[model samples]
Target chain A: MIRRLLLQHQRLWLLTIAVLGALFGLLLLLGALQLYFDFRSVLTGRSDLSQAQYIVVNKEVSTMNTFLGQKGFSTTEIAELKAVKGIRDVGALTGCRFDVNVTMGGGAIEGVPGMYSDFFFEAAPEAFLDVQSDRWRWQEGDSVVPLIVPKDFLRLYNFVYAPSQGLPQVTEEMLMLVPFNIVIKSKNGNVLYKGRLAGFSERINSILAPKNFVDWSNENYGPAVTAANEVKFLPSRIILQCDDASSPELAEFMSEKGYQTNSENLKNSRLSSLLRVIMNVCVGIGGLIIVLALLIFLLYTQLLISRSSYELQTLIRIGYNPKMLTARYMRYYGLIYLGILIVVVAVLWIGKSLFAGFMDEKGFPVPDGVSMPVVLLGVGFMVLFLVVNFFTVWLGLRKLAMPR
Target chain B: MQLNFRNVLPIPLADTPLPPGSLWKSDTSFESQARCLVQAPSGTGKTTIISLLYGLRADYEGQLLFDNQDTRMFSVDQWTEIRKQKLAIVFQDLRLFPQLTALENIQLKNELTKTLNEGRIREMAEQLGIAHKLEAPCGKLSLGQQQRIAIIRALAQPFELILLDEPFSHLDEANIRKAAELIMQSCTANGAGLLLTSLGGNTHFDFTQHLTI
Candidate 1:
């Protein structure tokens, strides 16, 4: 009978049914993707490295370093600490304080700590890497030109706060005028050789220059610059690479090594909390809509079944048992549900390209295998709809069959 | 048709059909207490008397008996079961299942009642001139064809009492005779008692008795 019904309605386009199926399939895919990404986060221990980090201040340059000296991790010790389990890594480099005077258009423009030399070779294990991946990568042909600055630099230097509507290009010339290169005097009041600005870093808090430049400066201007300027010469925070450092034990190990360790767990917990809130809200909305859809399906099926009262009564009169009648109608709706499911799956497959662009725009990471979950959800929903519809139909038919 | 048993009363009903009903009684004894053939107009009380005997209706002013057992021995649900299992009805409207083929309709009745007498059903269908229509859905058949199908469906089940209401109404004179003979033949074959409500003029075979109201 269902086959006959489908045959009769074969002229109707299957596109609408397929579209509904595809929508459900996409939602199913989204749910599976959420689970997959969550598992990846768990496996990779991304949660451990997102919290606060502690750095030891240099005693010579910073008055606060006196206190940090009692708590600092030595350069060599910090390297060893990196190999410890759960210790992600430590970053160490050097920084110099200078008054930067930008000489764009051959005019002086000034900012404090303007021309600090930073070790571009320093490795940022986690936190810095996250920020670095977004900025620019250095290449051979490209002169160390474009700068990627921290958001705080705009406030620190009183730069224009105009929102960039499009991507901004960075060039090498901007680095030349950062420090007002009047005279290079060390803490000892000795004169160092005058140096030219190579390039400015993205930000003033830290600077990035090739190591070769730093080696040249260290070799060319030694004690004179050091004596003229009373600046600290301490290795920056040490960075290290370990086998599996994204573990909680790394924090404990760092503390044991006479260094203050900041665990990333706090940051991870915060992120997880935010993620949970968002997930709950989204799932709650989706669940409510699905329930409503199921209810509507059941009600519609009941109405359809009840309209065929005479047909039911005739069956009863002819002595077709109640169970057999129920089975007959159940089979009919089951076929309808199967058809709906098949159409839904097909639509989702054809619409993947459309969703691809949408997901890319939304910054959602797409995975390779998605169809299994989508098909499972479609089939599950179809069965649920069929069972609910069957019961509703049976109830209506039973009322009609009740001896009156 | 005849008031042979005791405690019986005769009423001359003028061409009225009997509807299902009751008989009255006093405290010390029963007034209408015996078996009797009753004839009435279509609207008078023929159905009422037959229904009372079949225990399809129980409200009454007098007591009823089954083999000297009080009618109170049965409840209304039990009465329905009696109609289902022991008593068969041939409705004036025939009540043929519209969705079922004639064979399925007969087969379903036999299966539900667990009285599978396939040979008899086929024989009766052939005798009623409806053997060819057995596989056809009942609704597509002519009225006379439906009448025979209904009769065959009912007769296939073994019932002690068969209450037929206008079993011959749709039949022509030829089938009228054929249906009456078949009904009587099937009843006799099963050793079942039969009660038929019919128009007075149509029956050609002589009955054990007759009564006209």
Candidate 2:
């Protein structure tokens, strides 16, 4: 009975427009959220390192540096690079300063022939190494040295070098069991050490040994320093841990310092950042639309209250409680908002399924249903809208119930 | 249950010369179950008195209290509780939702109070000679019919006080007698006080006290 009296003067056209506006706004908001979720999953699936959080940078090798034999970063340069914005930490790729020779193949854990070649080694901090293995450790007196070789080296040998040389290719498990000898030649003497492959790294490209072993061997057998107190050696390359490799500030800093890194990784990072900015803009527009829709809903409520002021006053005068009237209005609009949420969810589910199928056909597979975060966001907005509208109704009726 | 007027005068009538023996700007109190009739001519703030007592208008010089609680300090919820269970009113304008049927107008209040069943509501409509007009929209009904509908709406609630602001102004002698009888019967049954305002005409119910405003 109270609903009949209070709603008699409501303008249905205004309400219908408001509801439509709410629907559109919610669809846009949830749709953008769902798309962001799918896009992130696709990116992570394609390549984990494509996020470009870790990058390797080096000085640009020019003719002047080559002529001067000065292709390494000094301590002051490393310190400056570490202080650059977006660069979290810097670890130098310390190269072997002593002459080294690796000999393998004849009875080296069942290889077919004898082979000997000069090899180079670089050492970086364990934190930057991607390969996790117990053997990738060494103490000063340990006779055997654990090494991490680049995975691309295995691919290169298997795909190009082995077939061309008429040699058999080996798997990673088989190579891990092989042991070779390393001969370190120094001004003091020649030292022989056993070398064993620990694991392969997909992130770093160098043949890596434990940092302590490299430092120990360099101190014992490396060439004498020009000065007694000069202990630091310049690194030719440095691997950086950065907050966002895509940030233009880092790029500008690198360029200003004449540093170079993998251009492909930077490109991918920039692409990801661009996508995020676009998504944020879309979400912002959706939020603005929702605000405008809420404003329209409030205006409609005010108009209804003023138009039905007489009837409301009559209801109050006849002993109808204002709270009861407000509750009736809340229930009515709550159901409408619930209906809007259901419609938005259904539409988003269908739209996402179709879009996911399209993406799958293009070799990018996203989740086939509406994401959980999107549903939660939609319901959260609905609840917010209901609360705002509820307050409007309550305030309007209270004014009518007790005019000041 | 008690009405206390402490030197209450409508803001608009503050500068005017009130008649002698008038209730305005005086400290007066009416105890529970007292039947009081206020007789006054036009433009004498009769409607203002009823509006003030019913928690509609607060533009007065002094305070109006309901059972020793100042009406000016009442919250919305408190006023609603008072209207639903403590006080009821039939406005002078006959503020009915004209789009609703006369039966719906009464049921609106009955639904909130739940003090009367549908059969009781129909019985009261029959007593007031409005049973035939119960199904008709209040907008199409005559002024007397709408007034009777408003009265039924007021009686459909439980109350300690019922304020009737010129309730029978448009009714004939026969209908007025019937309305007054039904109203007095409801008041006696509930042990509620009645404050009926009139424009100096024939009095229908036996009043325990009379005052001019």
Candidate 3:
């Protein structure tokens, strides 16, 4: 009956649908923003250190440091880096006090007792490390250590060391499966342990280990390093998570402190927050538009009921309850709102498909299936729309059906 | 099944279709099995009396009791149930939906009452001069045809009393006789009363009572 009645007013309904479509599209955009951020955050965690906003910042080697062998970044330098603005977090590197070597099966490399290559370790706090493969952690008594080598070292071995020594260069995958005995040596004693490859680092050009294992080993085999007011025991490099690499304030601060960053082209991960602000503005505007649209719809509904009040009053007089009258019109409007919801979902899916490649390039990929969060958000908005309009329609009917 | 009007005087109401006149200034009892008439000149509150009894107007001054219960205390649901199962009315303006077909207008009442099927409605329309006019929109029908449709619709429900205000004004004597016969038969079958109002002496039924408002 509502369909038959509304057919005469198709223009009115079409206008309503236009406004509703705009609202649905805005809500879908908000949902898409949520999906983009979540996917990007996940990808950032899974990818290399290249996407990390943090940089391994250190001071340049001066004449005093080269001549005096004072290569460590002092505690004062670490404090100054912490005080720098636009930096969210800071963690200094803890270095090993002993030389390290690795061999296969806890045995000698190439059947020699001491033919293993030279390597040392540095430990950054786990929060700063981008790659968190299960092989990256260590326990005190654990027989196996984890190796996060430098991609530069791998390339050098493949192109230079392999050709010079006539030894076959191995892939990262093969090297990962081969367990090597890690021997940590000091003037007091030498400790032998097994080690497995964790992953390669893209930014820092040093072998990295867990911070706990590094501190314990440094205490047991090397000179005791104080945490404050010391230069030799201090970190060699300070990593600061930058909000914006090109931010002039950060650039000025770095220049004033004579700090240089080895990780050039720092990923401006704070773009997420900026984009969130933009999306929130859009959502706020969308919310206001929705409110305005609802008011228009309410006024339109009142006009329609006013125009049809005679027939409605006649129906009410014919024993039709107010609930029946209200429900009949509500169901009609509910179906229209439901139609808007469907269109929103369809368009959002299409939008995701159209921008999948772009999002993937930005480290956030649109999934193939329907985005559940977007759909849920659309549903939420649809329900709110219906709930708000349901009252307007009911009030109109009550006004017309009841004695004024 | 009983309506009591006690010192009821019509008061002005906004958007009220009722005329400005009192129903009665004294107690009057209308029963389910009783037939009554309200005789008055045009615009003398004939429809106003019916509208007040129909619960369409509430601005009248005094008490109306349905089976000794005050009508004012009746909830909207109670009034709805009473209208659904007891009271039926044929408005003077013939308040049929203009967009609906004659058959659809009758079917709207039939849906509420569950008293008449399509076959019975078609039979009733055939008995009148309107079986051929049933499929046409009510707006397209002549006023006389719409009147017969309205009378058939009023009889389509189970009722304690059916109010017909100036129902046969548009119909000729022959069509009035036919519509009256149908209304009388339905009222008898349902064991209900009929309260009909008219401007002049045009009714043919053996009315049980008469009143001048």
Candidate 4:
């Protein structure tokens, strides 16, 4: 019998309900997907974010040999830098150049000059987990690990060559160049022995190898160093990853220990803040849409009340007094509100599944830890707000029930 | 219509209006008993009396009785249950649900009463000459048709007594006769007591009882 009454007024309910469900579902799905991707990137070190800031390293090049003497950052200095309060890790960075002599075929092939710098392998584990955890998949027998570069690097250099003709594709292998050299030394001249190339990166021109290997090789080679322009030494670029990024403890610690440290926390903070703003906008818009949807729902329900006033009056005439009227109408309100909530949840689930497919197409793998809880929380909030709003409207209409 | 008032109590009417002497002992034994249609005059407390009968007017000194029990012993909840199970009423204006179809308007009352009587609804519609407009919106129906639909809805409920206030206001002379006949037939079939208020000048149905104030 109730079904017949609803059917009598189906059009309005259908339109209002469909709109409510869609807004709630889309909000849930987008929030879940973004949270999932964020966690994945944080864990995998694939988030295109720079962890540190840079400072000027004065290189007094009285001669080319003196230029080599001012080798970026030594491994020993980096270790001491890590112990500082705000200094999380330190690394050496340099520019790239062509090798003066390396031939692959009959053609006069040039050897790729690699940027030899100190990399703090242990201090910043997340930065290398992508290669370290999955080393076996790409490792090959070589003293140095080959370079892995992104597809974009192809634009910087020509990788085209005919293997049969004995011409190499690209000589700028970031990984392989360092693996060929083994022993690495600290700034105080302590040395660490290393093995052959553990692996080659999938990315082109992007070569990442163990830190000890590169430092040792550069220390031994005098009057010459590759990637001179991109050198980073005792500077503010090191982020300690501690509670406070900007603290006097870090600056004093690095300065007193003969290790130069610059305060790049401000720059890093600015960048992080920018990223946080974008994230907040995405999530907040989802919440805002839900609020707007609830507003529309309230309006629709009010219209429903006006349209059904006569029916309510009829109920009154059918021996239903104020109390009975409240009970009967509340039951109806509860059912319709619950139905809308259920539909919203189901739609959110389906939309998340569809969005998962889209994310897969984009090749970013999101973990369950990030997706499930966010989805549940989003759906829960929507349902909660909707119920509160529904009860408020129902209560208002209850006041209109006349005594019999 | 403009109603004139005379001897209608200024404050409120309680069981016998303070007996015109002592302000105490107002029907002390009959607490739960409420009077309906005891008197009718254009403005001589007719609306107030109806309001009191429906329990809408609370400021009254009276011993209303239910089953020989005093009304004071019963709670508001008890009164509501009595209203739902034993009493029903139609308003002065034909408050037909505008969004509902003619059939739905009737079924709403039945459903609320927990009595799903679909067959009776269809039968009543056909007899009222509104069978063709059973599926039409109440807003689109003629005022006379809406009046019949309201009457049908009031009669379909499972109540001991049904009240009507200006029930046939929208009906023409012929339609009014038709509505009166149908209401009389349904009331007798259900054995439900009817208390209808209207101008006796135009109506032709003879009543078993009438008390003009």
Top of the candidates by lDDT = 2
Q: Write the residue-wise lDDT of candidate 4 on B55-153 in tens digits.
A: 555444444444545444554556566566665666666666676688877766676565546776778777777888989988898877888888887
Q: Considering just chain B, what TM-score does every model have?
A: 0.74, 0.96, 0.93, 0.71
Compared with the true structure, what per-residue lDDT tens digits does model 1 show for residues A134-194?
2244333333333333335444433333234332333334433343322333344533223
The best candidate by DockQ is 2
Interface RMSD score of each model: 6.2, 1.7, 1.8, 4.3
Give per-model TM-scores.
0.46, 0.84, 0.71, 0.48
Look at candidate 2 and tell me the lDDT of residue A222: 92
Q: How well does candidate 2 reproduce the true complex, by DockQ?
A: 0.60
Query: In candidate 4, how many Å is residue B5 off?
Result: 20
Candidate 1 chain A lowest-lDDT run of ten: A2-11
In candidate 1, residue A77 scores what lDDT?
A: 63
Docking quality band of candidate 4, CAPRI definitions: incorrect
- lDDT of model 4 at residue A297? 60
RMSD of each: 18.0, 4.1, 6.5, 13.0
lDDT of 1 at A320: 45
Instruction: Tell me the lDDT of model 2 at A227.
Output: 62
Residue by residue across A1-404, what tens digits does model 4's lDDT show?
44343234435655566466545645554554555345435433343333432332222334773655454455565676566555444443432221211112132224533434443221112343234433322222334333333344443344443355454465434433333233333344444333333343332123444444334344443224456544432322232344334334544454455444333543244444555566667666766776666666666666665665655544543445555444555566556555655665566556657765676678855432234455566557656755764575456545454333
**What ranking emerges by DockQ with the best candidate at the front?**
2, 3, 4, 1
